[model samples]
Target: MKFWRWLVILALYAVPVAVFFTVGVVVVWRSGRCWWLWWLAPLCWIAAYLLTRTWRKQLAPPAETGFVSPGHWTPRDGEAWHVVESHRRHVEDIAPGQLTDPHFYLQSAMDLALAVARHYHPKAKDPIGSLTVLDLLAAAQLAIEDSAQWCRQYVPASHLLTVDQWRTLGKTPAWLSAASNVTWAATVLMNPLNFGRYLIARFTTQAATQQLREHALGWFYLYFVSQVGFYLIEMNSGRLRGGAARYRRLQADLQRTADPPVGNEATSAAVTPEPPAEPLAVRIALVGQVKAGKSSLVNALLGRQQAAVDVLPQTKQVQQYELRVNATEDRLVLLDTAGYSDAGATPEQMREMQEAVRGADLVLLVMDAASPARRADVKLLGELSAWLEANLHRKPAPVLGVLTHLDQLRPTLEWTPPYAWREPSRPKEHNIAAAVAYTRQQFGTQLAEVVPVCTDVARGRAWGAYEELLPAMLGVLGEARACALLRTLHAELDAHRVQVLFQQLGRASTGLLRAGLAKLLDAPT
Candidate 1:
């Protein structure tokens, strides 16, 4: 019955193909001089191949879902980054048949694990052997969870799909394939010009399918590497010391740290894990020239007088204040640095301010809206940006320009509660608007946003702190959280390295003592 069905399909397909072949022969025989037109078919095929190659190079495969962002997951360490990138290139250039092997993904995952393990644990003969069974299981568990989450989110009704159903979906029906070929041949035979079109279409379809398959498989390989590599990094760094549960909890916390709450409270609460006992602290550095309202802004954020505000450069040193921004309980540490000189910061002061900025997750560049002098502010900000750019390991903290003393801008006495600086109508609003624009122009991309605020809450002049500044802070909290996580990871890596060094020393000393004792006892006996 199957043979008969295939025979019928071949008969249907052969009719149109035979017609096309006959027409080509007759045309070529009659028009001997124009027979060179036959070259067009091969040329079209060549063009199709070129186009497919171009697409293959241009198109990147879709990355797996549920993994942390590439920027975050990708190693900042030079040696580690090189290893992952090399693996990626290897995958891209992989043999076509390798995609179909059941163990291809496993092998790729193992290779990545071993490669990264060797880099981290170079002394070990079998780097992977150093990992505890629990560590390996934990890493595998996280990878599986990530893949499962991706399937759940992207593949609709995935749970309903059985093994047979999945296999059926992957396969093309033989009857349908035969019918399609016949239909395509008929389409080409109906018009001789369609011969070229037919060649191009066939080549394109075949090339595209091959390229798509390769890219899709390549994407999965890279995704597996990224997932496994990320957890491996944590394991090797000693951050996963508490076991799989602890690692998973840490991962969930990092996710929450990086991805801020979206949609309504119920949805956010449902998706978000319970607040950690010690929420990751996102440090915000308030930096500007003397009397730029740095302390006042800090006071406003904290809703109390924590940092002493004075006319004669009150904050002589970098002071940190614990702050809880609106809505989320993610701890924010506000760093109020010593205000710099109006002309330009001293080299010593610059070093101090830059150090504070370096440690910070975010920067609040306080500027006096009433005063136009920003040389010191701009110089310091430029230095900080330059420093951040030079440091390849650290993520650049997002900067928010806090334009203070908005009440003292123009129409000085006309302090309105809700001044629409965005689209100004009133004189005070217009002045505030101009200041914000000027600040933005001066800073360019340095500041994410410049918000005008009056932070003198003692004088009943607190505006835009909650409505503008806090919201702006929240807007960049996601990015700030990412920066914070990178810092935490680095700290853990350092601590882990130190711990490993001491452990090796302890082992060496213990071995030496045991050897000496054995020699002494044997000789006396």
Candidate 2:
């Protein structure tokens, strides 16, 4: 779309140059006004040059806002501007695969978790003493290492891995475990003097309280600083490799089309036809059961009060919300379907609903967290998965299970081994622990991340839990992957245009050079 727009602009500017040159040549040849007509050539050239420069400037990608230029390359400001602008564009149109890059979101979440740990457990120096802090650092480091491996394996010299793969690989429990160990080791090994001081304070001068505070602060500084450095290294590595890979792939794609022209009846007929117009955008449908808090979750994800809710099933039909991420303008077509129950839905209606779920890029299997193992929720999950396998077996989209209504979960329910969901008044620590264990077990291994959300809309507090989970969701969809996908799409569109130009040139009687020149002049600017 942008390329064609630029082509049209360039062609319009070249019109005067073409007309002036033709007129000047005719005047010199027919009227023998050589000197006067020769002057027009330079004038036409200057006009065309100026017009082309102006058009190029207009077509160039816009400069990035709020980026500080680093003085590494010559023309530092220009390079910085271009790099930032290109990255901005890439982010805007990231391919579905790139968004899944585990490193990007995994690192981000790790960074945030580390920040929290540093604040809360500043003095602890080992995983046993400060488990949360150790987990944060370990997770961040592991994510970086895993991401590096992914960069080496799948990221071609020209392109980054697709978002889906990135997310899938990043979320693996093995990666998280490795990261946890790294954090644990770092806390134990670094700055022994600080630990000694903390111990001495504990034993002597009755200043134990003050010494403990100092130790905590010192540990926090060390851990926080390391995390910052790790982020810098990881982000830089991704950018450098990603850029090089994209450039190389672009070259390869271009090279494949550099073959000599073929002239034959069969060859002419062998050309691939143009692709049908793309749907305005991808459409997604959301379906689940009644009192499932589907509407609340939809509102939270969309960041808008678009869906209505009641204690009873307020959503009766397929309600759709077109959602875009705040940071990245990636469109999500959310379809909220009528909640299923044994009583209300007919077989035909059930089949149609199942079809919608199967077609979704992702299905949000919403269930009440307070009632995690309800028969209806389990039935719905089974039905949805069955439909997808039976109908759309070739291309299966991921189903993201969502557990909602956490506030209602009995605070007193004790979580025992072989965890099961139970309702108790004034839930204790055991209950919370058991609930977590049970939820993980029920979901099985393929579950991306089970989110516990509060479904009350008036409070607007339930949505807070989603803040951390949203990035994971976006990662699954490969938000960054969209950039590469768009670039490929653009390249294909240009190749199509070039093929059309070649066909037009073949029909011309003039020499190839003259035809080329005419086509260039007539081509849309």
Local error of candidate 2 at 215, Å?
Answer: 58
Model 1 global lDDT (CA atoms, 0 to 1):
0.72
Q: How high is the lDDT of residue 497 in model 1?
A: 67
Q: Model 2: residues >4 Å from true position, as ranges? A: 1-284, 311-316, 342-349, 391-393, 412-433, 479-525
Q: Positional deviation of 354 in candidate 1, in angstroms?
A: 2.1
lDDT of 1 by residue, 133-215 (tens): 65666766766887799999999879899989888877756667788788668756765765776666566646655675676
**Which portions of model 1 show Cα errors greater than 4 Å?**
1-95, 98-250, 261-268, 314-316, 507-525
Q: How big is the positional error of residue 460 in model 1, measured in Å on the Cα after superposition?
A: 2.8
**lDDT for each candidate structure:** 0.72, 0.48
Q: Which window of 10 residues has the lowest lDDT sum in candidate 1?
A: 1-10
List the candidates' TM-scores in order: 0.62, 0.35
Candidate 2 lDDT over residue span 388-469, tens digit each? 4453212344556676665555642332222222343344434544655666687665355565555566754364334434
Top-lDDT structure, candidate number: 1
